[model samples]
Target: MRPKQVFVANHTSMIDFIILEQMTAFAAIMQKHPGWVGLLQTTILESLGCIWFNRTEVKDRVDASRKFREHAHGDDNNPLLIFSEGTCVNNEYIVMFKKSAFEIDVSVCPVAIKYNKIFVDAFWNSRKQSFTMHLLQLMTSWAVVCDVWYLEPQTIKPDETSIEFAERLMISHRAGLKMVPWDGYLKHSRATIL
Candidate 1:
C-alpha cells in the first residue's frame, strides 16, 4: 500500500496506547505479521524521525499537510499509525474518531484495548512527565489490561469520517473480548495507575 498517515484520535482517555504498545511488543513473538506497529501520526512523533506527522512551525503544519495530501497515494513503507480513538477513554467506551479516515484512501487496521484493571492517577518525580515515562507507567502497571484483540483490515470509504469508521471498529473489538465498560479513569504517573 502507499505511504499515508492513519489518525486515531478518540476521546482523551489516557495511556490507552501505552498498553497497546506493550501488547505489540509482546505479540511480536507470536507469528508472522505485516508492517511495523501503528500509531497516531502526531507532529511530535514526526519531529523525532517517526514516520508519522511532524510538528513543524505554524506555517509548516500547513506545508506538511499539503505534502502528505500530494504524495500520500504514491509513498509506501512509511505510512503513519493512527490512534483512531481521536480522544481518550478508559477502555470502557470510546467517543468517536476524528476525520482521519476520510483524509486518505487506504486500508485501516483497528486495534481495541481492554484493561482488566485501571488506575486513577499517580505521583511523578518529574514536574512534567515525558511521553515516554507515561508509556512506561502503562507497561509496568498491573492495573492495565493484559488482553488484546486485533480486527481484520477493513475498508474505510472515501466518504466516511474517522468517527463513523472508528466507532464501528471500537464496537466490534470490545464485543469480541466481552469486556465490560470502565469509567472514572483519568491520568496518572508511575505511582498512580501502576
Candidate 2:
C-alpha cells in the first residue's frame, strides 16, 4: 500500500478546497462554515471525512487536532488536505502557516494556488462577505482563472522542529506566491471582533 500523504495548500478562496478535491479524493480539516455552507459541511463534507472546527473555540481546535492526527495515521486511503494558512488570504500574498500539519511525523506535499484578477477577484474575505455572496459574485463574473501547482513533498529533517518544517513549506509556497509574516489567526480575531 502507498504511504499516508498529507497535502497542504495556500488558501485564497472558498473554492480552493474544491480545486484540490478535483485532483485527489482527500479528507480535509476546515473551519465550520456558516449557513448553507455549514449544512454542506455537516452533510456532504462530513461524509467525505472532512473534519470541521470552530476557529474561535479552543476546545474545538484541540478536539479537531486530535481527530486530525487519528485520521492521518488511520487506514483510510484518502490523503489529508490541510490549508496550513488556517484561513483564506487575498491571493496576493501567503500568510504564515500553522505548524500542526508539520507536527505529525508524516511527509507533506505542498500545493500552491494563485488566481488571475483580470477576470475576477477570487478571495472570499469572509469578514466582509458571506459564502453565498461570494458564490454569486463568482457566478456573475466573466470567468475565474486560477493556477494550481503540486510541489515536491517535504518532510521534517531529523533535527528540525515542526515550526521550522512549517516555515520551509511556507518558503516553497512563497516561491510561487508572495509571503507575509502575519499569522492568519489575526484575521480570525478581527472577524470575531466585528
TM values, all candidates: 0.49, 0.89
lDDT of 1 by residue, 39-85 (tens): 33332233322322333355655654555455445444344445443
The TM-score, computed over Cα atoms with residue i paired to residue i, of candidate 1 is 0.49
Instruction: Supply candidate 2's per-residue lDDT for 130.
Output: 77
Q: What TM-score does candidate 2 reach?
A: 0.89
RMSD of 1: 10.2
Best by TM-score: 2
Put down candidate 2 lDDT per residue, 1-194, tens digits, no spaces: 13666898888888888888888677899889778888888988887788889978999999999988888888754788999888788887788888899888787898888888898899987778877888999999999998887778988899998877877775445446778778977775635454
Quantify all predictions' global Cα lDDT against the true fold: 0.43, 0.82
Evaluated at residue 95, the lDDT of candidate 1 is 43
For candidate 1, the clash count comes to 26
> Model 1's lDDT to the true fold?
0.43
